[model samples]
Target chain A: MSAFNESFRFGIRNIRKRPYRSFCLVLAAVIGSYALFVGLALKASLNNGIGRMQERMGADLMIVPESSEIEARNILLTGEPEFFYMDVAVATAAAEIEGVECATSQFYFTSLSSDCCSTRVQLIAFDPDTDFVIGPWIDERVTSDVSNGSVIIGSEVTPLSNGKVKFYGNEYSVAGKLGETATGLDHSVFMSRDTMHGILNDAKDKGYQFLNPEDDGAWVSTVLLRVSDDADITAVEKEIYNRAGGIRFIETDKLISDVAVKLGSVENIINVTLTVLLVFSFLTMILFFSVIFHERKKEFAVLRILGTSSRRICFFSLTEGITIGAAGGIIGLVLGILTVFPFNHYIENSLDVPYLMPSVAAVILYGMIGVLVTTLFGSLSSFLSTLSLAHAETYYTMRTGE
Target chain B: MAFLEAQKLVKEYNRRGKTFRAVDDIDFTIEPGDFVMIEGESGSGKTTFLNLLTGLTDPTSGAVIIDGRSLKETGDKEISKIRNQKIKYIPQGESLLSALTVRENILFPFTIGGLERPSEERLLEVSDKLGITDLLDEYPSDLSGGEMRRATIARAVINKPSLIIADEPTGSLDSANTFKVMEIFRDIASEGTAVIVVTHQKETLGYATRVLEMDQGSLKEVV
Candidate 1:
């Protein structure tokens, strides 16, 4: 252990000895970790915020006419291959299954999207007035009487000119814009069930007809179904799968799991990101230890002569890497949160997409994994490099002072 | 048996289709408290022979026996402990870690071996004796050649080993620091510690009780 401490002391001193190379090494690590942390944080934040927003869907199951779970998962994960909805009948039938409670359906209309338009008008939708789950969820975002012809605008989606407007051509007022949900809800416009139906019927050609309406009528895009109070969620999910038949039953667990898999699985884009970050991390560590390795060759040779085992050298290298990695992980974690919050706020403002930091467990776990991986990488590389020399005669290595 | 002994030591290397004998078969010994000097020109295999004696290198044939253990029989770690507890080596050129303060550099050997030299009295005694008491905070990069040599010597002696080994410890110093380093050696030898220095400077012979010169990788006594 003293030998380990000595090697670490030597490692730090060597860094001081070659300030330029050490600076470049640490700078590379900080910046590389920064990029990785920010990417991870932003990805996680969006997933979390949208996840929180989707909680308003208020059920353990999401019913869609399209059974493409992978595409649905991807869309939920990274906003790819945008929203897919099913006929409103899917919701009404879903409520008849065992262990099921009330199921509600809603219609969504993509609002005016542009930089010049001030009145946020995205995801303008209608919810069934008698529904318990989906209707109440939107209630949080809408915060209006919602009974009359009045329309509730999101913080972003305002009137056509940021001025007041009649609700769905009804004689109702705009009521008022509501507080932010920090999600896509920021740009959503909410109106009464009757008013929303009228607008969707007018834009019915592209809106509700986006899904097959031939055998489907009184159609809606999303169905939020709640389980009975005494029913098990997992069992209810299975019941959902059995009853939905042709429709896609998205078990919320599978929903979140799919997102995680796509973000980090080995062959996916997350895999490409993983490869890039690993290479970058490896190169950063190698450059760091290599420079320190050259400076400390004599010290190591001397230690070997003084009796330090090769394993000891290897272990010391591991410890040194761990030390630096732990520091970087912690700093990177805090920096990641601080970095994402402001940018996320700006995203909510400019893009009207809400983002927030991931859960604490995710933040800590991701950081810890990152540190462990980099430590193993840096230590193994430097250790193998140092121990390769430990085999040759220690005396000769230090004799000519090369 | 001598305090330190080498028997029929041989070191050879084949380079460019030709064999170069770094050290031919040689036998020698050092008694306790001896002030011995091994003087030779550059590339005379003086270091090669010294390395074998110190167990820093393996001899092609023959053996180095220090105290009671054989270098070949003992493991590298045991050999290091033996060297650390019984002998101190001063390499050619500046031997201090460039980033450490003079005091920290002096305390390096003990620290590497995990021994403590408290700052209360032991440190003061050594620092005061070596005239480095005032320069404890300065790094080797800032020290003069003479001061670096002194600081290294202080580090070497901190363990109070039975033998002090110097490889051209005076080569880089001015006349004053060279003489100063030599006087420090004499003082260490006076305390019953064996002092063996490797140098090509004939002028340093004045301080040696006995001088051995290497010719064509062979040692001949000239005292």
Candidate 2:
């Protein structure tokens, strides 16, 4: 062990002697690993954020769409045909099934109101007293009217003293904004049932109704029903069809398949890219160590003449490489991950997403893996260099006498 | 038994298919405390002869026995053990690891040879003996040729090996530093370690108890 320390000191001394070479080797490892680390971190954060949203989709029951071509989240966010106003009359009858609970109806809309907002604004409506499904989603905004003058806005809703938005060239006050849904719901404005009716009716008079809400006559998107908590949802779904009428019942969650596919695609690309980067890093380390040994050929030979064994010299050589690699990996991991906090803002704003901060244990685990793998790669490269050259002879050195 | 012995030591080098015999049938021995100077013109196989005794290069035929083990028969590992435990070789100019501080350079052989750990007391002892005590913190590049040589000598003796081999140990020094280095070697040999020096200067003969002159790979008593 003491012999090892001595040689390690010697190794470090040699590296310090050539400051340029040492700087270059460490710099290459840091930049490459940092790039890879940052990419992987962003991808993981996205996956985690999507997972939470999917759970909100109601994990067990499959969401069935009236049509399968469009995205489910899009349907939930804006009642597209894919999300049928599921025959609102079916809700009252569907609740009478043996295992069924009370059922309620809701309407999701992506419409431009005379409310000055240029981006599409999301809106939803539920019977203020009866809609148990939207209960958890409702905020602390206390108002008695689910009518023309009452609105529960999303977190990003701009507030004003008077209710007026110049959408379709008229005025409306954003009654309130809901807590951030991490869904684009931040840009959404909710209206009392009467307010939504007024807006839609006005559109119809203007011959500007894009969706035929009268298809169901009292148009509502998917209905949410409370089942006996213990009752199997799949069985209840079947019973509802048999007892009431043949209708497709979907669990809220099955709608997130698009997010899942998006996540998977991103993961695949990142993994492939990471694998290539790791290989390149290995090669870079190998090239760096080889050049180091080449330059210090004389010094190593001198050590051998002083009586160091081949195995000892090789061990000493690898130790130096690993030290540098480990340092670079840690520095890269820390610098690469600091963006998580900054990303908190981005996800909140643009992705309409929120992510739990990575825990201390998690970040530590990631750092450990990063440093270990990097060091192993460096060590392997140093070992390969050792294998190709005889550690003892300093043959070239003795010949040139340099 | 001689403290160090090399009998009919033959070393050959193969270049493309032709084998060049560098050390040809050289028979030599040194008793304990003997200061034997081996002199030769350049290319007379003087360096090869040092390499043979030091086990840096192996002889193709014959044997070198140091402290009773044959350099030819023992594995390279065991040869190193003998070299580090019994003999120390100081190669020509540029002998030290230039990057290490003077004390570190002096301790290099001690540590690499697996001889002993260094303590401040021992470091100061060796440094003071070679008159390089104040230079312990300085690097080889900062020193004159004489200082480097003295530092190398301090390192060679730190392990206190049974034999000291100086190959052109005084090459870069003036007559003053050269004699200063020779005086240290003579003092070390007086303390019972055999010292072998390879040099061309006749003035260096004063420090040697015995001298063998090498001419084209052969040795004989001179002066």
Candidate 3:
């Protein structure tokens, strides 16, 4: 047999001899690694959810009424319907800005306030001619355009029938359902401006004067603007703020920064807990191996007398440690992957926050790294335990033999 | 030149601020095919002298030379290589690794030296010679004291090293097994390997070509 094979066999045999001790060490590693995996997966899923939100937003700057900027963002983050509107003329004015590529207007309307509406759902309306964000996405999901009386639903929007959703006593045919973005958009319904106008007119006929379409000052909730590739977004933002006439420009980057700031304490808690767990596992391994090495001093001394090099003896111990640690790591990773990933929806629901899991490949890579680090720590512990043996006198150990 | 030589060897221990000499200026030599035995009372430093000769412990004042190489002149790797290739040591008591089977214990020298383990025929030959062929698959815990001693001796000779230093190879064995172990060492020495055994049993000294008695860290030849 090869030298490595021989040493590995000896290491395995030693571990088998003390199954309880080995089990405790491995259990410590598993707990540490499992904690790390869960933390990383949660972090990755949250980041992925944020990424999808940013992608779906597809706007460099959003213009809303200066008084309702916070409420507009709240409406986009949570599907909680609220009455917030700015002049529809803001879309045309924002389109005239120097660095603005395209400006699209969105209308937020709730069908749930009307007792005549069948389902309590937040309704979003976009102009097919001017919309650049949700329009292209809808096109990718469906072959036909959203015609006069039809609608497209978000992935989370559940209609009573396959082809129609009830809105203000009118049934609109469902064009298609969007893929899950794990964002507020998943809970909102999308239609053209004409359809939104029809819904409002129908609500007006039913005596809801709060949202009449033909009223003197008609309004759109928000104006989504894209910046040109050659233009500096910060400069455009500054200029838009300067030219803002009773409206505010909220940059897309600010939304993410806001969420991070809001959840910073939770993130810090997770990170600190993970760091403590990792350190505890490492120290536990060191202590365990220290005791084991002290107990096995006579065995190692015999090996030294039997013509084994001190280096080889150290290697043998390290091999045993790494084997146990690696086994624990694998079990931990498999448990995390099987338990934490598939149950991500439950975590999302409990936290009531955005969460999207990373791809399988990314998770596997993280698992590999986790196992490698665990094994490395195990090897480090082994090295530390054998330091005395490296310079010890074999006769002393042999004299104290069992 | 002697096949193995110990020149002015000394070992000292410090306990509670007092220095005690364990092996005091011991000088010894053994040629090939020599079966040398040393007898000493308890705490007379026979094991200490054996440890020094095997390079398992460093001498405080002198060196052990094996095959023209001084143990003091070589680095750890070179010394370990030399020991693996040329010397075998059986320390006092039941030195068998409790975790390993009797067969694994005998093949340990080969594993440590990075040499291929002995083939089945060679292993069977060694095991049969030690009268442990029936117990090859058993752990050391299951073996009798005499059987463990014989197994340790089997491991020592399995590599066919040029020198074997055994400290009390039969100190705890019964007369029958003690005689059996001495005869095996004699046969090993006759095969052209030098053997040095440290023990207090006078009956087993008959198998030795030379016998020495140790007392109070000193050695005198026996007539």
Report, for every candidate in turn, its global Cα lDDT versus the true structure: 0.65, 0.68, 0.81
Which residues of candidate 3, in runs, are more than 4 Å off? A58-75, A78-105, A109-122, A136-143, A148-150, A153-182, A194-254, A350-353, B119-122, B129-131, B144-146
**What are the per-residue Cα lDDT tens digits for candidate 1 across A257-298?**
553454334224534675687678768777667666665666
* Tens-digit lDDT track of model 3 for A24-105: 8888778667877887887787778777877787888888888988777766676556667877777777788898999888
lDDT of 1 by residue, B7-122 (tens): 88899888899988889888888876788999988989887787778777788998988887788998866777776667888776666767678887776666666776656477
Off by over 4 Å in 1: A1-13, A39-270, A302-319, A345-357, A389-396, A399-402, B118-131
Models sorted by lDDT, best on top? 3, 2, 1
Counted clashes in each candidate structure: 10, 16, 0
Measured on C-alpha atoms, candidate 2 has an lDDT of: 0.68
Where does model 1 sit among the CAPRI classes? acceptable
- The collision pairs in model 1 are A45-A356, A88-A219, A88-A220, A111-A121, A119-A158, A120-A156, A120-A157, A120-A158, A121-A157, A182-A354
lDDT score, candidate 1, position A305: 47
lDDT of 2 by residue, A1-402 (tens): 476676677767767887887776676566556656665565666665565555444323322234532444554433222224455556665666666656666666555544443335666666766666445556455434446655676665665556444334445665554554444445566665666676666666666664563552355655667677787888877766664453555565444565556557766876887877777777787888888776666666666666666676687778777767777777777776776555665643444333334556766666677777776766777777765444445444545446
Order by DockQ, highest first: 3, 2, 1
Quote the chain B TM-score of every prediction: 0.92, 0.90, 0.94
Q: What is residue B130's positional error in candidate 3, in angstroms?
A: 4.0
